[model samples]
Target: MGGYGDVQMIDENGLRMDGRKPGDVRPITIETGVVPVADGSCRMVWGTNEAIVAVYGPMEAHPRKIQRQDRAVIDVAYNMAPFSTTDRIRPGFNRRSREISKVTKDALESVVLLELYPRSKIRVSIEIISAEAGTRCVGLTAASVALADAGIPMTDMVVSVASGKVNDVVVCDLNKEEDNYGEADLPMGVLPNTGELVFLQMDGDLSPEEFKQAWDYNVDAAMQVHKLMVEALKGGANS
Candidate 1:
């Protein structure tokens, strides 16, 4: 909880620091084909966090050993730009970025029909240009959009969201302040059409009921975000 002593994150009217209700998510916008050179690309902004994702390949798998005989492999690299946050991050792959990349690859691999392209690789690169909080979730969501834009066969798109407890109240999405000071965080990647989860992570403390509330919030938020994803893909096709 980062020693959030006596911090009042919610008002008497039950509104949060940014004037959002407990179940309200921050504003979100998504656009496709942001990287023209990539086979597929998307840019997504959730609150102040912005992530750009590019997809390349179903090309021959490198190193040969990484290739799968029956399906394609998904290689994901998630990175934060030096200027993305207040403190400049060193340029290189770190533990945090590696973990995020692995989880993101796992999430997308579940939905992508990799068997269609055996002995191949699909590369997903995620760049966080700006960060407020929940960059992992945003990156995963944008990667899903980018894959779709690339015309990859997939069973469903993955929608990621995080819900957390702040000041003993469960909120749908955590901004920078809430994430820094919140008591608990639960992030999940959901397949909206099937209501299945491809990713899940949590930290901090939460009672059983609070955990349930947070889970429900993430599920609902994923459905809402999935709508926007579909809309953005459709718009890209028309344009």
Candidate 2:
């Protein structure tokens, strides 16, 4: 939390600085097939954060060591462009990106039917063009849509969302300012159909009650986002 002593993020009416209710999420827009060269692709904009995801393969897993006999492997790379942040991020892999990539791969692997494509590899590339916090959630969610756009068989789509405590109040879909000053954060990836979780991460501090509030907020927000995901996927063949 950054200098929360004097700054006020919530007004007397309980409205946030952005004029949203505590549980409200930021505006979200999604488009599919943004990358024509890739087997499947999607672009998602959530609040000020924007992410593009491309899915390639289920092609032969190169190097015999990487291939699994019973199921395909999910390879994910999460990267932020140099201009994605206020200060130019240096090019190339970094520790933060590596951790995000691993967790994202784990999340997707849970939903993608790897057993269907034996001895193959599915590559999911997540690129962040603009970031305003919650980029990981945006990347993972967009990747799921991109995979579906590629006609990949999956039991369910993953919907990711985050909720955090700002000014001692639990809020959903935190913006950049809130995130920097927030006391705690909990990000979750939900299976919209079954209410099951494939991803979960948290940091900072919160009481048990506050934790429950954040968890509930993320689950509810996921359902709302899931509707948009379904709509985008059904609108056209490319999506």
Candidate 3:
């Protein structure tokens, strides 16, 4: 978080600086089967954060050692485009992107029935075309959609979202400014139907009550985001 502490992010009406309630997430749009060449793909836009995910797979695993005898391995690469931020980010694997990619792969492996396809691999590539904040969550959420589009069997889809505290108030789906200047951040990946968590992470400071509020906000946001995912898959061909 930034050191700009005096920036007030909440008003007396309990509304956030962006005019949303404490639990309200920004607008979201999702589309599936977007990349023609990939076996499956999804594009999602949350606020100004845009991510595209491509899935290729159950193909023969390569480089012998990485292959598993009982299940397919998931390879994920999370990248941010040069033009995706206010300051251009150089292309390559940075620490932040690498960590996010690892978490994304882990989250996906939890839901996908990988053991069904031994000696195979699944590649999930996430490209951030526009990043506001929570790009990793958006990428993970879209990856689930792409897996579904590919007709891969899974226990359930994961819906990811972030919530944070700014000006002593809890807010859902932090934008770029809030993310940089907020007091705390909690991101989680949840199964919409079961309310089970597959991914979790937090940073900065928050009291117990504040933490609960953030978790609740993420839970509520995930359900709404799931609706968009369903719509996007239905409109895949048209999109």
Candidate 4:
């Protein structure tokens, strides 16, 4: 929750500030093989946010202390470039980046079949080239595509989306303006094929009914996004 002011984010037409009906997600485009040198890579643009993810290894888990004897570990580094936001983001690891990275790693771990590659490690690098809002969800979703592009084994691909309350109405995806003034945000990661959840996080409050609306919005949005992910992968390894 950023601001609780009486800023109207929904209009008389019952549409969001961005002219979307409450259940519409931001526009998205995903492309794979963006990083030629990496084992796999994907570039995703969601609304005004853009993220590039590169996956490397199942090679070797460096430093014996961090090595696992039976399964591979997923290492994620989520970073925002200096000019990622309107205000310059100071480069380097910060607390917020660390938390997002850890949560992303956790979500990926749930779907990736780590046991297939014993005692190895996979490194996922998430770079936010531009930001408006919901970068974390974008990063996680794009990372899954990068893993698939790299030919990794996974039980299912993850599709992440967020829904929130603004002006007493629940919207499918909050744009920059809505998020800055919204009171609640619920982000989720879904395994589209199985209808299973790999990740869920909430900030602020929602009544049970509001919560269900938001939840359904995310699930529906995930299924839609998953279709695009599959399309991108099918489109080939270029771009």
| CA lDDT, every model vs. true structure | 0.94, 0.93, 0.90, 0.93
Per-residue CA lDDT of candidate 4, range 108-162, in tens? 9999999998888999999999998899999999999999999999999999999
By lDDT, the best candidate is 1
Better of 2 and 3 by TM-score: 2
Better of 1 and 2 by TM-score: 1
Alpha-carbon error at 231 in model 4, in Å? 0.4
TM-score of each: 0.97, 0.97, 0.96, 0.97
Q: Supply candidate 2's per-residue lDDT for 16.
A: 94
The per-residue C-alpha lDDT of model 4 at residue 151 equals 96
lDDT of 2 at 67: 97
Candidate 4 residue-pair clash tally: 0
Tell me the deviation in Å of residue 217 in model 2.
0.5
Q: 1-239 in candidate 3: lDDT tens per residue? A: 67478988788999887888888899887887789999999988888899999999978899889999999999999999999999999887599999999999999999999999998999999999999999999999999999999988999999999999898888999988889889988999999999999999999899999999899999999998888788778873324
- Tens digits of lDDT, candidate 2, 171-201: 9999898899888889999999999999999
Give the Å error, residue 203, model 1: 0.2
Off by over 4 Å in 4: 236-239
RMSD of each: 1.5, 1.7, 1.6, 1.4
